[model samples]
Structures are given as C-alpha cells and as structure tokens.
Target: MEILWLSEEDVKGSLSMEGTMEAVEEAFREAGRGTVQMPPKSYLIYKKYDGDLRTMPAYLEEMDATGVKVVNVHPENPGSGLPTVMALVILNSPKTGAPIAVMGGTFLTNMRTGAAGAVAAKYLAKKSSKTVGIVGAGAQGRSQLLGLAEAFDIEAVKVADVSLDRCRALEEESRTFLDATFEISTDIKEVCDADILVTTTPSRKPLVKDDWINEGTHINAIGADAAGKEELDPAILRRAKVVVDDVVQATHSGEVNVPLAEGLIALEDIYATIGEVVAGKVPGRTNEDEITVFDSTGLAIQDVATASRVYRTAVEKGLGIRLPFL
Candidate 1:
C-alpha cells in the first residue's frame, strides 16, 4: 500500500475559504445530528518545555471520513524561528482503518478554525454586521478575518495587539484581499467597538472587560484551548447567549472552563451547541439586541472533514507523493 503525502503547500493550494467553510459547516451539522464520533482531545503536557501535545480523533459517519491530528502548542517557538503551533493530520479509510493520506495540518488548522468562527457568526451575528474587531493579530486572527470577509461584507476592521508591527502587517496583508479600511491599535477595548468582536489572544486573565462589549455584539472566543487560559471576563459569558462547539469540551477547556471552575457560571448557563443551531434544533439570534458568543475549542471532526476534502482533490489532480508502506 502507498500512503499519499501532502505537504503544507499542497494543502494550501487546494483550500479556499468558501470550500473550507462548507466542509466545516457540514461537519458541525453532522455533530448536531449525532452522526459523528469525536472523543474529547487527549493532552500530553511538557512542563519542562512549556508546551503541550494533543491528539484529536474523529469519525464522521455520514461522510465516512476518519482522521487524527497530532498538534502542539509551544508559545515560545517564535524565538527559535518556528511557529507557535504546528500540526499534522492523517486521513484513513473508514472501511478498513488503513491510512490513506498524511498532510500538514497547521494551515488546515488555521483555516478550519476560522471557518468555524465564520459559521458561528453566520448564525449568531446579525445579517447587517459590517464592522469587525480582532483582539489578537496572530495566525488565527488573520485566518478569522479571512473567513469573516468571505462571510460578511465587511466595511471596517479594527485590530489590537501588543506589537505595532504585527498589527500593521495584518492590515497591509489584508489589503490584498479585504477592501475594508483597517485600523491598528494597542488598546483592546478600542477594537471591541464593532458589530462582530473576535478575541484570539492566549491570555490567562480576561483581556476584554464586560463593559467593553456593547449590545447586539457577536463575539467569537477563539482562544483558551487549554485549562487556565481565558480571554473574556466571566461576566461577558454570563449575560450573553453562549454557544459552544462542544459542550463537554468547552466546560473542560474552552472559554467557559475557567469561569466554570471558579463557579462564576455553571454548565446550565450554556445556551446551545453550534451544531444544534446549524441543524435547526435551536434558533440563532432571535433579536438584534441580544449578545452572542461562540466558544470554540476546535474539533477533530473539522480537521477530518477538511483533510478528506484536500486528499480527494490531491488525488484527482495527481498531486502529492505516494510512498510505499509495508
């Protein structure tokens, strides 16, 4: 048997915002319909290196897509000229449990996550939302903006970060695709004044205060993938309609994890899962004045779905190297 090997470039060449969003959206629907099997992520902490490795496995029954992603988060890797996060996804044939493809998952991770945010905003954010705010100007932040531009007719973009260089770089980079006027600031609250607010920082404490959020705002809480990491104040979650990618996962490591552990909120405070909303089991954004939040912990089903899409495309295009295995 030969396993197809797809590099990051191959994956990037095959992905588009629209295609990824479609794939990821369908995966969420499958999750809502209970047609997917995704175990909570398992972690291996490397305290000595200040990093952690996580394994995510999933099988989408209807789609017959199966994959596992091995990812790592090392915040200090930039100093060594490496990305802060890197991943690899291996797609397998659900029929016989044979590995079909192995592809670089870092870019897939960014794109799928951004697609998840866009899907959440599509259901939760108002249709008239024109302005977007991004709190962390990192890889995830850039991807989120890319997905948002595809989902909404964005008029203005506000970005806040510690480094002026990163902020301006995002603005300049966005000009190639995004026509919106870009504003860069170091003030996180200044970026909060928008129709849609996205917080992607890896902050242990709340960077966005409760009062900073206004009425009718839709927030995509993209950070806090692990325990003890939080970006929004617990109060923000308390009053808003909180939707999670996965309820049990969110309660353990998503944005609500810290708050739940501290007793600031309870599991009952969650409004609904994004999958349910997409599946039409629950309504999204009943009124214009209601605040909404999508707590995303990132799902393996997303990776599996997107990886399958790429693998199919690669095979059709005669791309990727097929190496003999066993």
Candidate 2:
C-alpha cells in the first residue's frame, strides 16, 4: 500500500484558518449528534522529563474519517530551541484498516485548538466583542489570535507573559499578522479584563482572579489540559456559564477538572458542551451580562477533521511524497 507523508510545512501550508474552523465546527456537530466515536485521551506521564505523551484516536462516522494522534507536551523544550508541544497524526481507512496518510500534527494541533476556541467565542461571546486578551504569548496564543481575527472584528489585543521578551515578540507578530493594536502588559489582571480572554499557559495554579474578569466577558480556557493544571480561579467558574468540550474529559482533565475536584463546582454547574451549542441543541450566550467560559481539552475529533482537510488538500495539490508501505 502507498501512504502519503506530509511534513510540518506541508500540513501548515495546506490548511487555512477559515477552512479549519469550518471543519472543526462540523466535527463538533458530529460529536453532538452521536456520529463520532472519540475515546478519552490516554496519557503516559514522564515526571523525570517534566512532560507527558498523549494518545488520541477518533472516528467520525458521518464524515467517514478516522485518525489517531500521538502528541507530547514538554514544558521545558522552549529553552532548548524546541516547541513545547509536538505531534504526529496517522490517517487510516476505517473499512480496510490501512494507513492512508501520515503527517506532522503539531501545526495541525495548534490550528484546530485555535479554531475550537474561535468557534466557542463565536457561539458564546457578545457580538460587539472588540478587545481580545491573551495570557500566554506562545504559539497557541498566536494561533488563537489568528483564528479569532477570522471570526470577530477585533480592534485591540492585550498580551501578558512571564517573559517580557516573549510578550514583545508576540506584540510584534500580532501587529504584523492581526489587524489590531497590540499592548504588552506584565499584569495578568490587565489581560483578563477584555471583551474576550484566552488563557493558554501551562500554569498549575490560577493565574486569573475572580474579580479581574468583568461581566459579559467570554473566556476560552485553553490551558489546563491535564490534571493539576488550572488557570482561572474556581470562584470564576462558579459564577460563569461554563461550557466544556466533553463532559467526561473536561471533568477529568480540562479547566473544570480542578474546580470539580475541589468540590467547588458540580456536574450541574456545566451548562452544555461546545458541541451541543454548535449543534443548536443548547443556547449560547443567552444574555449580554452573562459571563461565559469555554473549557477546551483538545478533542481527538478535531485532529481527525483537521488532518482530513490537510490530507485532501495535499492530495489535490500533490504536495506530499508518497511511499509504499507493507
């Protein structure tokens, strides 16, 4: 059998933010409609290396797409001139169980995660959202801004990071990439006080305070994908209309995990899944004064949808090299 191999550049060049958001939205709809099978992510913690490996697999029956992603999160990689997150995706044929394509998933992962955040904001954030705040000035932060610009008419951006250099770098990049004015701040509170806020750090404790968040602010809690990691204070979640990507996963590892584990919030505190909101089964942002939060754990179905898009685009453009596999 012949399998196509796509590099990081190939995958990144093949997909666009608009197309990725559309595909990811469809994937969420499929998940809500019970047409997708995505098992919870399996993890192998490497405490010695201060990192972990995750295996995510999913099959979207309606879309006829199946894929698995093996990704790793190493917080210390940045100092060594490496990315904090890297991944590989294997696209397979469900019928014959044959590998159809193999591709780099790091870029795909960032794009899909950003797209999910954008979709959540589109459904939950106020229509007049003009200011965006980003807590972490990393690759995910850049991707989130890119996706949000595609979805909303963002006028200004506030960025906060532990490293002033990273914040400055992000400010420069945003000015060039996004049609918005950029401001760098050392105070996390300043970043949290915007029309829409995105937290993408690997922080173990709450970086955003309860009082810092204003009413009608929509927050995309993109960090805290593992146990013991949280960004926003539990008090914030207690009052906000919390939405999760998946109930099972979110409660165990997503932003809701810490709050639920602490007994500060219950399962009933969660209003609905992003998928349900996308499928139109649940209402989003009922009132302008309501505080909304979308807790994202980065589902496997997102990988499948995005990888499928890259695979199709690569094939159409003849981008990847094809090799025979036994």
List TM-scores for all candidates, in order.
0.99, 0.99
Q: Put down candidate 1 lDDT per residue, 1-326, tens digits, no spaces.
A: 99999999999988898999999999999999999999999999999998999999999999999989999999889889998889999999999999999999999999999999999999999999999999999888999999999999999999999998999989988888899989999999899999999999878899999999999999999988999999998999999999999998998889999999999999999999999999999999999999999999999999999999998888888888999986
List the global CA lDDT of all models: 0.95, 0.94
Local error of candidate 2 at residue 296 (angstroms):
0.5
Error (Å) of candidate 1 at residue 104 is 0.4
The candidate that achieves the highest lDDT relative to the unseen native structure? 1
Q: Candidate 1, TM-score vs. the true structure?
A: 0.99
* lDDT for each residue of candidate 2 in 1-326, tens digit (9 for 90 to 100): 79999999999889999999999999999988989999999999999999999999999998899989999999999999999999999999999989999999999999999999999999999999999999999999999999999999999999999888999998888777677888888889878879999999999999999999999999999998999899999999999999999999998899989889989999999999999999999999999999999999999999999999999999999899999998
In model 2, what are the clashing residue pairs, if there are any?
A: none
TM-score for predicted model 2 compared with the true structure:
0.99
RMSD of 2: 0.7
